[model samples]
Target: MQKTCLAFAVVALLQPALNLWASDASLAVFEKRILPILQASKPSSCTECHLSGVELKDYIFPEQDKTFAALVKADMIDLKQPEQSKLLKFIERRPEKPSLITDKVRVEEAAAFREWIVAAVKDPQLLKAKSTASVGPQVSDELIRHARKDRVLNSFAENVWSEVGRCAACHSPDKNQAQVKKFGNRVSWIKPRDMQGTMQNLLDSGIIDVDAPEKSLLLAKPLMQVEHGGGQKMLLGDRTYKQFRAFIDDYVAVVKGTYKDAKALPKLSQEVSQVSEIWLKIEGIPKSLDKQFLRADVYAKTADGWSKERVATGDRAIFGGGGLWQQHLTLTAPRDSARAKELLSAQKLAGGEYLVRISIDRNNRLAQDPNSDFTKEDVIGEVPVRTNWPSGYGAMTVVKLPAQTR
Candidate 1:
């Protein structure tokens, strides 16, 4: 009984020393492996998931004890099972197709954190350490999520990728082989059907000026504010230009971390649209309306009367001398609606009778204010037409202006 009592006393006396030794070892691991991550000039593994606003170093500190304590206080470290630490889980999260270099960095970062966390949790001193210092990003969770790569990509797809068709003839790798031979591969800014690759190419080619978004070559070149080999592909206040600016401006804001809350983030449009090959022509346009912007909204004839929403829309400056206005149509639908899903797979206007509402910008409002949109007051007339909306410039559906206006 005395021998057993003495054995218990020895362990009780050595407990504090053992904890101190274990704590020192854990601190060594943090200083050697983890501190390098904090001090490195390059971004850590967090870049794999976050474009900005968050980094692995945000959870670390110069002082090991402070970092351990803060992480503990924030519930980032799981004492019962250190391997299941939230910080480790966060570090492990990766995109579907991560860059090889970043993936390597991610592996190293996860291993370093796992080693330190496993050892530190076993040290009673680290478990008992207390700290008031914050251990993660200073921004709100909403901002962090907004800065995620997936979210950024989705925004790119909606605002910029959807408009690439306007530039694809000269910019896409699949179609710009001749341009590449003359202008070098630099002109092939777009990857074939790869949104992420296209975005990266834009960034790498200095087309997207995050620092001065308005001055970006991507916007300036298309607007003809800068010399462009493709001539003027987009007007200053046209739908294509608006969509590009919306994406570039928002991308700059996101990277700069200017938004304080979710409300500050830019709102997405309720409607979705896609450029299509379907064309429309209106004859007998007045010479006075020449060079004036004309917009046409096509509504499918439904059992009730017409679709509550326009099925397709097209806009362009009228040709006064030709006494007609012609442009390709853009399929439209409310986002997330059944129509939107259908348009996603196929951009075809079904064969049927339709009502075409025409609006004329007499005051040049769109040019004066790019943000201005057509309203009921802008409607000049409505013409009824019946035809299968075929695809191609050669198969354009033709209609005449209302007799009153003609």
Candidate 2:
């Protein structure tokens, strides 16, 4: 009886922790790591203004959204570049307000905030809103092989040496600038645009279709023959053209679900799915693992709303197979599941697309290492789920997975 009571009490305690784990991964870490800093400071009610939520809410820039929040959590900001980062300016309050703290608590909080800002500035994902990897056309391997072979004929490199094909002479892989005297001082350029905004504009103007191959510039650009002002055509035969094409495709994918007009990316809310099977294997858990962590609950949405579905009990449900130290979690996306249903439910549109969001909280111990001091909740990396359903409804999930620390 005592063992049963103890087990029940433990399960009750873990329920909320797991729910928080499922909700927003960063929140758990954020509240744990930074809440003390904020509470300790106790900003003045004076200064002729009052801001809500410990840290002057009104002082924080309006542009810093959830993604930025992750950056903050991760502590990837540079304190010196106030103009470049709002967090630094907000915290230093150097030229703004040098006289807010009157106690040790406030002084310590201010110092911690400054240290976090410096670290946050170094995170690349926070520095730019988009990623920069280029995976070229969606063609088959055979097509890629053929394309490579065709490049051997009077290749752009050969032309450069002969003083004709100035592709390499001007746009050197080293310094991506033009070699003015050699290439007539002019090179065709496609300036990077806010990919999410550009795609939204095209969609709103009816210039593209979500599914139609003809609607996407990605599908059409390769075959375009018109001179691109500087005399380069979007031809499949040009190696230079292929490089630029690949860059644009990747930019589009990163912000695929982001809407142009929405000030920030929208949060995901629900996913529709039906239960198929369950698996559990955390039986004789090892001592090294954090046993305080419990099994995560899986859920599916329907006309009635999100319904709880059992997957596995305790840590068995956690996807944990990646060889050595690698770990992962298993979750289902309704669309990929065999038993998805489209039932009408109230929709909330934040950005352009519809999305399902997962909410969960987990624990993190802050005192383990001094280097961990630089970490903050807002800087952690996240994966976004964005979709457009045939029924005119959409869903998304802004995922916060465990950091793949190298």
Candidate 3:
């Protein structure tokens, strides 16, 4: 009993000294490892999941006591079980195929925080430390989620990937071998069904200018604001240009953390559209209107007159030489509607009688002001049509341009 009491007393007496040693050790590790992470110019492992708005450094501080206190106050630190610290778990979160360099950085970051946390928790001083300093992102959780890589990719799919068909003939690797030979592999920006790969390539190839999204090569080249071998594939304010700009602008804003609230986030288009192989041809376009841009909105003939919304739409410059205009139709529906859900898998228009409203941009107004749309004054004419809306240029539903109404 005496020896047991003596041993217990010795341990009790040495406990304070042991804790002091542990505190010194944890401080040393934090200074050498965690401090370097905070001081490094490059981004931390948080970027593996977040494109912006959060970083590992945000959870850390130069002073160990303040960092520990802030983390404790924020409920980010697991005092009883340091290995389960939220900070360490965050550092460990990584994508399935992380970049080799960033993966290495992630491993080092996780290990550093793990070691520091494990040691720090054993130090009573650290557990008792009090600080008013706050840690973590200053942005709201909505903004953080908006900036996540997955969210960004979903936006890319909606605003950019869906429109790649317009550029696929010259930029898709599977189809652009000849262009690849002439312009190099860089010309094959589209990765054939790989949305994430295509987005990464766009960023890597400098096609997306995050600093000035309007000046991005993807938009500039298509608009012919910069020299492009493909000529002008899109006008300044056309549907394709609008979609591209929407994604680019939002991406830049998210990366820069400029959106302060959910209300500030870009509003998603109320309508969802997908490019379809179904073709529409307008013949007998007056030769005088040659080269003028033309738009067609197809509305299903319902018992109530028209469907009140265009079921399919197409636009192209009039082939004045052929006295015609033809292009693939884009099926569209109000977002979250039953029809929108159906169109996701089946890009087709129901067979029925329909009204085709035609508008001609005779003044090149769309080229001058992208925001301007074909108004009632621009209506060339409306034609009643009947067809199954076939799916190829060889089998397009042809309509003669109505005599000018205005």
- Best model per lDDT: 1
TM-score of 1: 0.94
Please rank every candidate by TM-score, starting with the best.
Answer: 1, 3, 2
Report lDDT per candidate: 0.88, 0.31, 0.87
Best by TM-score: 1
lDDT of 2 by residue, 76-190 (tens): 3433573355444444343233334433434554555454444434434344443232222233443332233122221212221121122333333233454444444223221
Which portions of model 2 show Cα errors greater than 4 Å? 1-166, 170-224, 228-234, 237-243, 255-406
lDDT of 3 by residue, 1-406 (tens): 9999999999999999998899999999999999999999998878878988898888888899999999999988898888998887788887988889999999999889889989999889888899999999978999899999999998888788877877899999889889988999889988998999999999888899887787999999987899999997777667778888889989999888889898999888888888888999988876777778888999998888988888988877788888888889888888888998888589888888999999888788988887677888887789999999888779999998876642
User: Candidate 3 at 67: error in angstroms?
Assistant: 0.5
- Where is model 2 poorest over a 10-residue stretch in terms of lDDT? 310-319
> Counting only residues 3 or more apart in sequence or on different chains, how many pairs clash (N, Cα, C under 3 Å) in candidate 2?
48
List, in order, the clash count of every candidate structure.
0, 48, 0
